[model samples]
Target: MHVLETERLIVRQLRIEDAEFILELLNEPGFIQNIGDRGVRTVADAEQYILNGPVASYQQNGFGLWMVALKESGEPIGMGGLIKRDILEDVDIGYAFLHRFWGKGYAYEAALAVLHYGRDVIGLKRIVAITAPENPGSIRVLEKIGLRFVKMINLPGYDEESRFFEVDF
Candidate 1:
């Protein structure tokens, strides 16, 4: 399902057909360094991740990480949307783009759109975001989207602390 649109991007549901793109995005050095490796070493694994992660989330939770694509070419550039982590109290806005798409404002535009969807359509009251403490770029984006830094979080499986931020609707 197509969810939202920005001036330059289209945010939509992820499909099994997106495995190729997911494989590349998940293995990018920046994604591994900042978001951690998803261990998707093969295309099959990527398909499974799409099924179990985003597709399943959409079916069961009504929202998940959406594929962000260029409106002009319909080329997917990243993934972003509402994530319901078992460890978090509120839905978190999560996103990651291809390395080539960095520093281009797509993250901000996609995220800002998702946040609005979370509030206006999903009826969410509190939305949070987490990023590695050293990721200044992500921190800047989160802050730019109006989520205030709340604290450092050591989630159940993380080896290091993640900076947590939140915005209350």
Candidate 2:
């Protein structure tokens, strides 16, 4: 079920129908490099990705990445929501957008909405966000949402360096 909606965005569950858009967004050059290589080559693969990733998280954790859509056009722009990360042992806010939507504040808008939902609605005491040290843009979004830098840590199952940010409700 959809949990949150903003003026220009709707935060809802990732459906099988959203696979094609997920493929395109995950394959964006900046998304691949900055958000890690998802290898979402085909719509079928994207469907499985959503099932194994966000959908499973929702089933297990009660919260997961949401499909972010523009209300005016009803176009899926990206995803943003709370995720349970192995390193944090708690939920964290994560987001991604297509390259075409870069510099448009869509990420910020969607993320703020999700953050509030995770805190006030879901009753999460604290949420964390992890990003590559070099991805300043993602870090900025975390900051804009009131997350403060906590530390640098290597994520389990990931060899790359990552920075952790946190916010307490």
Candidate 1 global CA lDDT score: 0.95
- Maximum-TM-score candidate: 1
Residues 15-114 of candidate 1 have per-residue lDDT tens digits of 9999999999999999999999899999999999999999999999999999999999999999999999999989999999999989999999999999
Alpha carbon deviation, residue 50, candidate 1 (Å): 0.2
Cα deviation of 92, candidate 1, in Å: 0.2
Kindly report which residue stretches of model 2 are placed more than 4 angstroms away from their true locations once superposed.
none
lDDT of 2 at 112: 92
All candidates: TM-score:
0.99, 0.95
Alpha-carbon runs more than 4 Å astray in model 1: none
lDDT of each: 0.95, 0.88
Error of 2 at 11 (Å): 0.9
